[model samples]
Target: MPGNLKDRRGAGRHPAEALTCFCRDVLTSLGVPDEDAAVVADSLVRANLEGKDSHGISRLPIYAKRIRECRISARPDICIDRDGAVLKVDGGNGLGQVVSYKALQAAFPVARETGIAAVAVRNSNHFGAASYYCQMACREGMALIATTNSPPGIAPWGGKRAYLGTNPVAFGFPTRREPPVIVDMSSSIVARGKIILAAAEGREIPQDWAIDEEGLPTTDAEAALRGAVLPLGGPKGYALAVAVEMLSGVLSGAAFGPHVNNLYKDGDPPANVGHSFILIDVEHLMPLEEYYARLERFIREMKSHPKARGTEEILYPGERSYRTYMNRLREGVTLNPSLKSMLNDIGRACGVNL
Candidate 1:
């Protein structure tokens, strides 16, 4: 771990404040228009606030390169056209945050009318954690599923050459007034971003997370980057990853496989990333209060169940992150020394100290 691991000082920031800083400094440095930068930055910082470090500020450098290289548009007047409950959004190569946010924002009203709405986006870059948007929909009493695809970072089942991005999927559901149940995960054994972070920190990666260049598993981050990551559960994970690729990348007509430039290598233009978001109004199934009450009961049972002999406690996804978020609220967000330096560089380029 970085020296700051024990120091909660830079653990996390307030959702709103971190959003502003990331937008103003990081995106602005990437040359995005002020307004567009704000949109992109807000979502990224919100990911951090939710304790998703892999999808947070650590992604800024790669996003900036995309912007500076014209792979991502700094100013996109996105076109969101609706076909009944479906929305097709042309992102104009804008930051994924701006495009995805606008698409979901528009989907909200459409879902209200039809009890469900879905949006597909094309020509956009990475949009941070998918749960951030799902959580947004959950706040409105909607069950949401979000997915995004990137350039190929993993090999398909029974295949060698990398042909898929990690391809994350998120599902968010709200029951009554309790905290929403949010599950966000990548189909790959681990996020490529997390591997990059591990490499940067000179930390050893887990062997199962990736394979070496020789097609063997390795615990070395450098070797993993040179190789491919495994699927979550063999064929099942591969199937899910392929599904995401089709829905997000193929449906949106974005790039796929190795043809897409690697975000860390920082060469070549962005592959015109794509994403899809779905929102379902719980009111259509049943009243929100009734659904939530039942959900709360389920949660109570699951959380209060007897513990295994070796296990201390059982936790649903997003539980640990919530604790970190609460603690980090009192302590400032922590940054690795190296990351702090990079942020300073962006600040200097943008002529702002934030």
Candidate 2:
């Protein structure tokens, strides 16, 4: 393992609940309502627990700064407009986490009645992860397909300059197991936030992740940030990104491509990110018990199929995250030196103690 990776592995860890409390305190102090702040904090902390540190508390400072600048509404007046099984949500420029949660909440009842429902959200910020909303729907016995558009970070395939965001698509299905089966992936080889996290820690990224502005592959995190993240499967990933942008950005009537403001850039306009969600009542397709039984059997067969040389076991989508979440709940979540210092600075600035 790299020295930086080893060091991070040995870094100080904090209990998940404590970190969530700290995040909530910081947001609440910045004029966010208690409920909204808790929702955001829980989403961040859950990301940490699931081992997605890039989208965890590391983003709190930026969120706080945006809230203070009035770029993100502290108390947004979210509005939902319904058209049969389709719903349109105007986030009122509220925090993405809160707005997405509310949008999903509004879709569930309609989905239950209509068998399937879709919600399109506009004027929202960056929601932590698409999987979070999908999983929420899964827990309610609904299968969910979710997608979102972000600030420009990845270039369209065959191009050098950025024109498309590292859009993501996620899905979740309830199973007989505790954690629902979930898959979440960005169209890029890696999520843009991971690159930003590496830059913050002064760690180098893999050379294949991104290319410098000059269209040369670089491992330097700072240089990569100035460049564009590469698509996951070449043209296929690029195509998927465009599809997500159409559904999330154009369909939702939110800013698309370069029009979306950069979330990390300080003086920019509000990040008018967009998200789209589709919920299907699984019970409508088959009996819940039969569906769960068949899914479990399929998972079992896949896991037992075979293991290649040097492989420990076969794991399915969301299985690794489920294990990480369980382990973190008991062993606590680790924070590297840089992240710890950043959190401390945020706490000091906000008159909160971590």
Query: What TM-score would each prediction reach against the true structure?
Result: 0.91, 0.96
Which predicted model would earn the best TM-score? 2
What lDDT, from 0 to 1, does candidate 1 have? 0.78
The digit string of per-residue lDDT tens for model 1 on 1-354 reads 224633534443233464467556767666677776776676666666667777877777677766777777788779988999999888887878888888888999999999998888887778888888877898888999999997677888987667888899999987565567889989998888888888888899988899887778899998888888898998888999999988888886777666556555656665678899889999999987788788888888999999989988888777777677666555646667787677767667767664
lDDT of 2 by residue, 5-82 (tens): 335444587778889999999999999999999999999999999999889999998999899899999999999999
Clashes of each: 8, 0
Ten-residue region with minimum lDDT total, candidate 2: 1-10
Relative to the unseen true structure, what is the C-alpha lDDT of residue 186 in candidate 2, on a scale of 0 to 100? 100
Candidate 2, 139: how far from true, in Å?
1.1
